[model samples]
Target: MSDDDLSEKVGYGHPPKKNRFPKGTSGNPKGRPKASKNVANAVELELDSKVTVIENGRKLKLSRGEVIAKTLVTKAMKGDLRAFDAVTKLLPKRFREPLAEANKSEPLDPYEAEVLERYISRRIAKEDSHD
Candidate 1:
């Protein structure tokens, strides 16, 4: 039966008031947890160490604290700031500071970072292939 029929069958004369969240309010108070914010933050692993090193000498330290990042795939595809910022993943931590501080140090030359660039390109291409 419809709501009206159910109301009639209940014989309460009127139906109970419906409930809903307030406008612009989220039901989840804690909100969603974030990804890693900085590369230095530490995280916990159930069995093993939480730290994980990526390609080359790049290392990515996880964080239990909140972050301000979206998914890496989207960042790569959009070529957003994070995409450019992510080149730190190729070099060691010590190299990153010096490179950024260098007078003539070149930015991550997408063409020069062949292996990583190609890998990203292939992944993106594959993702797009289905569409």
Candidate 2:
């Protein structure tokens, strides 16, 4: 046998061209199904589904996301610190804080002003206590 044929016979990593996979075919044709949705898509579908919830002794139907948000807010209001953090995280960035504008002079509403004052005071107190 020629050295080329001998090397092909004992090739370490390279498979013979003829016996290798065809140009377009996948190595794992039976692998994960093409229609399988990813985690985010699955979660979104789940959250979009409606569920029954009780509010003020009245049964109401709401999306899973709404139910979850309500539950998180209720827990946070009841002093669950982790839930508070989760609720904050779930809020849109703009809702969490006012967007900065260089030229806009939009006045803060009473609630917004109160919240801002409380936030600033807490931050200042925290900084003072750290010193």
Q: Which candidate gets the maximum lDDT versus the true structure?
A: 2
Per-residue alpha-carbon lDDT of candidate 1 for residues 21-65, written as tens digits (9 for 90 to 100): 567978797888898666344332332344453535766664322
In order of listing, the candidates' clash counts read: 0, 0
In the predicted model 2, the residue pairs found to clash are none
Candidate 2, residues 1-131, lDDT tens digits: the string is: 56877667536777776778999998999987678678999999999999998899999999999998888999999988789889878779787675334336778999999999999899889879999
TM-score of candidate 1 on Cα atoms, chains taken together: 0.19
Off by over 4 Å in 2: 1-36, 98-131
